[model samples]
Target chain A: MSAHAHSEDDHGSEGHDFAHPMSVQTLLAVFFALTFLTVITVAQASFDFGAFEVATVMFIATIKAVLVMAFFMHMIADKPFNAIIFIGSFVFVGLFVIFTLGDSMMTSGSFEPVVEELAPAVAEPMEVKVDGAP
Target chain B: MSTIEASPEVGHDDHGHDHDHDHPAFLAHHFDTPEQQFDSGKLGIWLFLVTEVLFFSGMFCAYAIFRALRPEVFEGCSQFLNTKLGAINTGVLLFSSLTMAWAVRCSQLEQHKGLVGTLAATLSCAMIFLGVKSIEYSHKWGMGLLPAGLFAYDPSNPHPTDHPNYLMYICIPFAIALAGVLLWLVVSAGLGNKMHVAMAMPLTVVCLCFFVGVGLGMVLESGDETAEHIDVHADPNGLASAPVMLEAEKAAAAEAAPAIAASGAMVSVDESVLEILAGDASNTGVTSGLNALEQQNAAAGTSTITGDEAVVGAITTTEIDVMTPTTAGVFFSIYYCMTGIHAIHILAGIGVLVWLLVRAVRLDFNRQYFGPVDYVGLYWHLVDLIWIYLFPLLYLIR
Candidate 1:
C-alpha cells in the first residue's frame, strides 16, 4: 500500500494536483537548526555587544524565521503568489516600524520642554509635603 | 469555516447537489476538482496568515518603539524574566511546529495513525507552553510585577507575605479537565467501545501534559528562586547588600529606631554586618526587630551601637534601585501585551488543532482533501514564527 501510494505520488507530480509531502529528515533537520539557533541566541545575551546587541539578536531570529517559513511552512513548494503576499506583509511591517520609529525619534526632542517644566512643579510639591509631614 | 467542517455528511450533501461534476465528497460544489478546491483553500489561508502577520506587526511596532525609547527599562525588566523558561518554551513551540508539519506530511501520504500521533504531540506541546507561561505570569504577579497602574514591586522584599498562590489557581482548570478526560477513559473502557477508548487514551495524555507543564514550571521557578537566594547570601559586596540595608531601614521605620537610639552607642556599620543584619531582620519580621539589632551589633564585630544611629546610617548610605514601577512597568506592559496576544493565538491554534484532530480521527483527509490540516499547520507555523522573534526580543534582551 505504501509503495502504491508512492507511485501515485510520482504520477501526480507530472500533473498539478500532487501533494507536497516533506521528508521526515528535512523536518527534523529544520527543527534541530531552529533549536541550535535558540541556544545561540540565549548564549549571545550574556555578552555585551554594545550598540549591536539588538541587531545581533534580531539577525539570528530572522534567520530562524526564514528557515521556518521556507521548510516547515513549505514555502519552497507553495505557490509563488502565496509566498509573495506573505513576504509582502513583512515589507509593509518594515515600513510601519520605520515610519513610526523615525517619527518618534524626530519628535523626541519636543518632549524635553514639557518634562523640564513639569519637573520643578512635581518636585517642589513633594518636598513641601515631606517637610510639612514631620 | 464551513469548508473546514467537511465532515462526511456535509460532503454527501455537496455531492447530492452536484452529481454532474463527479468530484470527491470533500470538494465543494463551486470547485471543478479536488485540486482546485485545495488550491483555493490554500490561497485563502495564506491570505489569512498574511493578515495575522500584519496584525501582530502592530505589537512588534509597539515593542520596537518602546525598546528604542527606553532601552534601560527593557534592560532592567527583562532580568526578571526567566531566560531558562523562555528557552524551554521556544524549544517546545519549535518542536510542536515540527510535529504539525509532520502531521501535514502524514495526511499527504495517507498515514492516518502517524497523523493522529503527530497532531496529539503538537497539542501536548501547546499545553506545556501554556503551563510554563502561566507559571511565568503568576510568579511575576506574585512579585507585584504588573502593568503600569498596578505595579507595586518592592526591590527590598520582592516576595511579599500576602501574595496569592497563583499556581494553585492556574492548576484548577487543568485539574478539572484532567478529571473529565479520566472519567471519559474509564467510562469508555467499561462500555467496551474500542473507538472511544482510543480517543480517550490520547485525550487523557494531552490533559496530563498540562500538569506536566505545571510541574515543570513550578520546579524551574522555585529552582530559580533558590539560586537567587544563594547568590545573594554568597556575596557580601554584591548589590544584594543594598537591598539588605533597605530592609533594615524599613525595619527601623516600624518604630524601633528611637528606643534603640536612646542608648547612644555609635558603632560604624559595614556592608557585611548590614547584610547579615538585614538578612535576619527580613526573615524575622517586625517582632524580631530588637533581636535583629542585637545580631547587627554582634555581626559588626565592634563596639555596640543603638538602632537609631544604625538606621540613620543605613538610610543615608542607601543605594538607588532603578527598577521602580514607573521605570520597569512599561516594559512589562509591552511584555504582557506581546506574549499575552501570542498565548491567545496558541489557544486559538489548539482549538483549531482539536478540530483537525477530530477530522483526522474520522479519516476525513486523503491526499486531495488534506487542505484543513495543511492550513492549520500553516497557522501553527506562523504562531511559532512569531515566537521565534518574541523569544529573543523579550527574553534575550541585552
Candidate 2:
C-alpha cells in the first residue's frame, strides 16, 4: 500500500472523523507508567541480586523504553515497515555488542608479551661485568 | 520562538495536494501517510535511544570491570556516599517527568498557560534535582573523599599526602568551581524570589567558601607532595629506574620518620604528626581511664602487645604507613574513574534538561506535539537509573 493510503483519517467513506492521533490522556498514562518503571528499577538496585543486578535493571529499562516508543510515540498505529526498520537496527547493535564482548571474554588470556627486535646493530655495545678489572 | 516555520502541506504536488483533501492539521507532509509518519518517528526514536544506551554503556563497562577486580575497594568507597540524596534526586526527577507529561497534556488541550505552567514546574524540579546533586558532590569534595585517581586515600599507608592523585588534584577543583557557579545561577534564577534570594545569598557564599577552601587545601597539599617528590638525583650510569627508585626511597623516608619519632629514635617528627599522635594518645588515655583496672590486668597478663591489637593500631595509622601502596593504587583508580564519569554525565543531562525547559517556556510543545519532551524525559530517567547503581556501588557497598 502507498504510504498515504494507510492514513486512517482519509478513509472517511463512512464519514467517521480521524481521531486525535495522540490525546493528553494517553500521554499522561505513559508518563506515569515510565516514571513508575524508573522508580521500580531504582528500588530494585538496593537488593543484593548478585549476578542478576545489572541484567534485571537493564531488562526493566528495555521495557520502559519500549513503552515510551509504543504509546507516547504512537508506534502501534504506525506502519509495520517502521517496526521492521527498528528491529533491523537492533540486530546490528546486538551483533556489535555480542561480538565485542565475546572476543574480550574468550581471548582474555591470549595476550602474548610483545617483544621488540633490537635496533639492527646501529652501534657496537660495550658490556661491563660485575667484577671490575676488564 | 524562531520565525522560520515549515508548512505541513508542502511537497505533495503530484496528487494536486491541497489543504481541502482530508489534510489532518496535526500531520506533517513529509510522510506519504500518517501511519508512515508515525512509524518513521518511532523508528528514529529507537535508533537514537540505542545510541544513547551504547554511549552510557561505556561508563557501565568501566564500572563492571572495576567492581569485578576490586569489590572491596568499591564497597569501601561506596560507604561514604549518601544514598538518601540519590533517592531524593530520583523522586525529584520522577516528579519532573509528571510535569513533562502534564505539559504535553496541556499542549493537546491547547491550553497554552497550563502548558507553560507544567513546563515551568518540570524545569523547577530539574533545577531542584541539580541543586541536591551539587550538595552531595560538594560534600564529597569538601571531605577530600573523591575517587582514588582524584583525591586518593591510603588510610593503610603512612604518607598518603606523598601519593596524592596529581591528575584529580589538578582537575577536580576547576570542575567543582564550575558546578558551584552553575548551581548558584540556577538557584538564583529558578528559586530567586525576594525571600529565596535572602536565604540563598548567605548559603551560596558559605557553600562557595567551603568549596574553595577544600579545593585550595587539596591542591596545596598535593602540590607540596609533588614538589617534594621532584627527582634531582644525578645517576652517572643513567639508569632508567633511577627516578622511580628515588621517589620510592623518598616515600620510605617519609614513612619511617613517624615510627622513628614514635619510638623516640633518630627521626624528626613534623608538627602534623606530633599533633595527630598527641590527639590519639589523649583520646586513648581518656578511654583507658574509664577502665583502668581491666587495662592494668591486661598489661600484667601479656607484656608483649597482642598481634590483633597491634594490627588494629596499624590499620588506624594506615594513612601514616607508606608500605602497602598497592591497595591504595588499586582502589583509587576504580573510585575516581567511576564517580568522575558519573558526575560528567549528570552535568550533561542537566544541560539537556535546561534546554528542554527553555523550549517548554516558549510553548513549543502541546498535547499532540510532546515527542521531544517525552524523549528527553526518558533520557533523564536513564541518567537517574545509572546513579541509583553508582550510589550503592561507590558509596554504600559495604
Candidate 3:
C-alpha cells in the first residue's frame, strides 16, 4: 500500500474509512481506568490480608500493566510479532522471579539466623573500615 | 509525498543506501518500506525493554531476598515511608503515561499541536516525579534514616542507641558538602576544557585529602572521648558485655519515659539520669545532645508534654556511638537501587521525548510515519510499568 494512500490528516479526512487508527474516546477511557486502578492499589494497601497481600497487590499491578499494554500503548492492535516482543519480556521477568523465589524458599530457614548476626554490628563503636590495618 | 521528501531534515539515515524522493524523509535508505522501518525500530525498542526488565530484575531479586529474610524489618522500615507521597508519585507517573500514550496517538493521527502539548506535559510530569523524590530523599537524609553505611543521624529512631555518634552531626553535612563539591569538580573536569585537566587532577587530590583528613580527625578525637566514657565497657574482642550494660540503661530509660513527661510540674531527674539526656553540655563546643531528641519529641508529642515546663526525661543517654546494624538498611539499599535506576530511565525518557517534541514542531511525524513517537511511547510505558510494581513493593507492602 502507498504510504500516503489515506493521509488526508486533521481535515477533509472525515469520509475516509478508518483513516485514524485509535479514537480519542478509547484513550480517555483507558486514562480513566488507569487512574481508577491506581486508587484501588492505594486503598487495598491499608488492609491486612496476611498471605494474600503480595499476591493481591501484584495481581492488581499486572491488570494495570495489561490495560496499559492493550489499550493506551496500543499493543493490542500491534502486529503479532511486536506484541510477542513486548509480552515476551514480561514472561521472562516472571520466570526470573519464579526461579529466584523457588530457590530461596527451598532454603528458607537458612536466613533466619542472619538477623542476630546483623543486629550487633550497630552496637559496636564506629571504626572507619577502609583506613585500618594498612 | 513530494512535500515529505522536501523535508529531509527529519533525520535522514542512509549509509550509501538511498530512498526515492517520494519516500518520507524519516525513512532510512536501507528499508524498502516505511512499515518495515517502523517494524525494525519497534523490535529494537522491545529488545531494549527486555534488557531493561532483566536489568531491574536483579534489584527485584535483591528486594525479594531481603523481604523474605526479614519481613519484620521491612515492615518497620515501610512505616517510615510516607504512603501519601508514594501514592502522589504514582498518580503523577500514571497521568504522565496517559499523556505519553496520547502523544503517540497524536503523532499517528497528525495532530502536531496535541503531540507537542502531550510531550511537554509528559516531560513536566517526569520532572515532578523527580522533584517529589528529591524532597523525600532530603527529609530522610536529614532525619538520619540513611542506608547502612550512612546510618549516623536518625533523630527520629526513638532509641538514642540507634543513632550514630554525635560527632557526625558535624561530619555528615561537611562530608556531604565536600563530596558534592568533588562531584561537581569531577563533572566539570570531564565536561570542560581538556587543557585544565592537569590543574583539575591535582585539585581533585586536594579535595580527597581534605575529606579524609577532616573525617579521620573527627573520628579519632570522638573515638578518644567515647573511650573515656563507654570504651572501658566495650570488650576489645567485640563479644564484650557493653550491650548488657546498654540493655540495662535502655530498660531504666524506658521506665523513666513517664517520669520525664511529668517532670515539668511534679518530677525531678537524678543528676546521673540527667547526664544521659543532656550529654554533658559543659564539654566545650558540644551543645546539648537533647536538641534532636527534644525537637523530635516536641513534634511527636508522645509524652503529652502539654506545657513548656514538662520535660520529657532523657530516656537515652547513649552518648554518641556507632549504632548496632539493623537489617532495615537493606530495605533502603534496595529502595535506592531500584528507584534510582528507574529515575535514570525517566530522565532518559524525558530527553528522548524532548527530541521528539522538537521534531514534531518541525513537522517530522505525521500519519504516514510516527515511528519515533511510537518507539518512545513504548519505552515510557515500560518505565511506567516498572513503577507500577515498584510502588507496591517499596511503599504499599502490607
Candidate 4:
C-alpha cells in the first residue's frame, strides 16, 4: 500500500493536494474542550478520591493530550506510520513506570523500618573532639 | 526505493543550472515531489516527537515513583502553587495552541497576513507564559521554596521579610529588550522604512507582553496575599494572635529597658527589633542571649543593630514546619525539573517561531511548502501537551 502511495507521489503533479487544513470550528472546539477539561481537573483536586485521585487526574490529562495530538497536531489526517510510532512510545513509558513502581512498593515495607531506626541518629548533632585541647 | 533511486538521476540532469525551474525552490533536490518531501519531514518530526516523549517520560517516571513513595509530601507542597495562576497559564497556552494551529492553516491556505498575525500572537503568548513563569519562580525563590538543600519555607511566615525582589531582576533583560525594540520602531518610522517599521512594531508588542505578564502576575499574587492576610486576621488562632503575644513581650522588654539606660548605653529600639524580640520571647534562652548581646554591645559602646542578625534571629526562633528540604522539598525538586525543562522548550519554540515569522514575512509558504509551519506547530503543541500534564500534576494535587 505504501509502495502504491509512493508510485502516485512519483507521478503526481506539482501543487498536488496533501494539505489538510483544519476548519476553524474544529480548532476552537478542541480549545474549548481542553479549557473545560482543565477546569474539571482543577475542580477535582479539591475533592478527595483516595487512591483513585492520580488515576482520575491522569485520565483527564490523557484526554486533553489526545485532543491535542489528533487535531492540533493533525494526527487524524497524518500518515498511519507516524501515529503508530508516536502512540507506541507510550507503551514503553507504561512499562518503565509500572516495573519500577512495583519494585519500590514491594520493598517499601523493609525500607520504612530502616529509615525510622536511622532517623534519630541522623538527626543528632555530631560532637567534635579537638586534638590536644584538653 | 525505486523512486528514491530515480530522483537523483533527475536532479543530476539539471545540476548545472542556477535555478531548477522545473521544481519550486523550497522543494529539495533529493526529493522528487513536494508531497514526498513534506511526508519525509513530517515523519522526521514525528519521530523526533517520539524521542521527546520518551525523554520526558523519564521525568514522569520519577514523579510517579516519588509521589507513590510519599504522597503526603506532594500534598503538602502542592498548596504553595497558586492554582489561579496555573489555570490562567493553562488558558494562555491553550489559546496559543489555537493560534498556532490556525497559523498552520493560514500558511497552508496562503493567507500571508493572517499567517503573520497568528505567528506574532503565538510568540506574544509564549513571552507571556515565560513572564508569568518568572513571577511564579521568583515568588517561590523569595519564600525560599526551592529544591532540596535550598528549601527554607517557613509556614508561619511564608514570605520572608528580607528576600530580594526577584521579579525586578527577572524583568531587567525584557525591559532592556522592550526599550531596544521601541527605539528601533522610532528610528524606522523616522527613516520611513515601512518594512523595518512593520517588523519593529510586532517585536515591540511582543516585548511589552512580557511586562504585561509580570504586571498580571503581580496583581494576582498580591490579591492572593491580601486574601491570605484577611483570612489570618479573621482567625482567632492564626497569625493574628501574634499581636497579643507582641504586647506581652513588649511589657517584658519594658522591664529590661531601665537596666540598659542605667548602663549609659544609647540603644535604639525599633519596631522590627521589637517584633524579633517578641517572636523569640517564648524561647527564654534566646531572649536572654539577645539581652546579653545587647548589654555587651552597650559595654563596648556599639549600639548599632545589623539587619542580618535580626533576620537570622527571627529564623532561628520560628518553628520549622514539615515542608523542609527533607520532606516537601523533594516534590519541589521534581517540580522544578519538569517545569523548568518545559519552560526551556517554550524558549526554544519562541526561537523557531521567530524563524517562521521571518519566512512568512517573505511570503515563502503556500499549499505545497507549509511543512516548516506544520512541523513547528506540532512542536509547539507538544510543549502545550507537556504543560497539560504538568499543571494538573504539580498544581492540582489533592
lDDT leader: 4
Weakest 10 consecutive residues, lDDT, candidate 2 chain B? B305-314
Question: Higher TM-score: candidate 1 or 3?
Answer: 1
lDDT of 1 by residue, B242-306 (tens): 55545545455434444544433444433223332333222222223343445455556554332
Query: Which 10-residue window in model 3 chain B sums to the lowest lDDT?
Result: B278-287
The local distance difference test score of each candidate is 0.70, 0.45, 0.59, 0.72
lDDT by residue for model 3 (A51-117), tens: 7999999898989999988876677666667678767777887788777766776755423222323
The better-scoring model by TM-score among 1 and 2 is 1
- Residue range B1-398, candidate 2, lDDT tens digits: 11222434453443333433433444475544434344356456666756665665555554554444334434434433454455555566556655665554465465766765565566556555545544444434443444322443322222223333443453465457556755765676786554434333333443343344334433433232222222111123434554454355344443534333233222122223332232212222212222222232344543221111122221222223211223333344445555566556655655665555555555566443555655555455455545545544444333
- Report the candidate with higher TM-score, 1 versus 4: 4
What TM-score goes with each of the models? 0.75, 0.50, 0.62, 0.76
Model 4, position A101, has a per-residue lDDT of 73
lDDT of 2 at B286: 19
lDDT of 4 by residue, A106-127 (tens): 7553111112212321332222
Per-residue C-alpha lDDT of model 1 across residues A10-77, encoded as one tens digit per residue = 44422434688999999999999999999999888767787898899999999999999999989998
- B45, model 4: CA deviation in Å? 0.9
Best by DockQ: 1
Against the correct fold, how does model 1 do in TM-score? 0.75
Q: Interface RMSD of candidate 3?
A: 7.2
Sorted on DockQ, best first, the list reads: 1, 4, 3, 2
Candidates, DockQ: 0.29, 0.07, 0.22, 0.28
Name the weakest run of 10 consecutive residues (lDDT summed) in model 4 chain B.
B307-316
Where does model 3 exceed 4 Å of error? A1-20, A108-134, B1-22, B153-324
Q: lDDT (0-100) at residue B348 of candidate 4?
A: 97
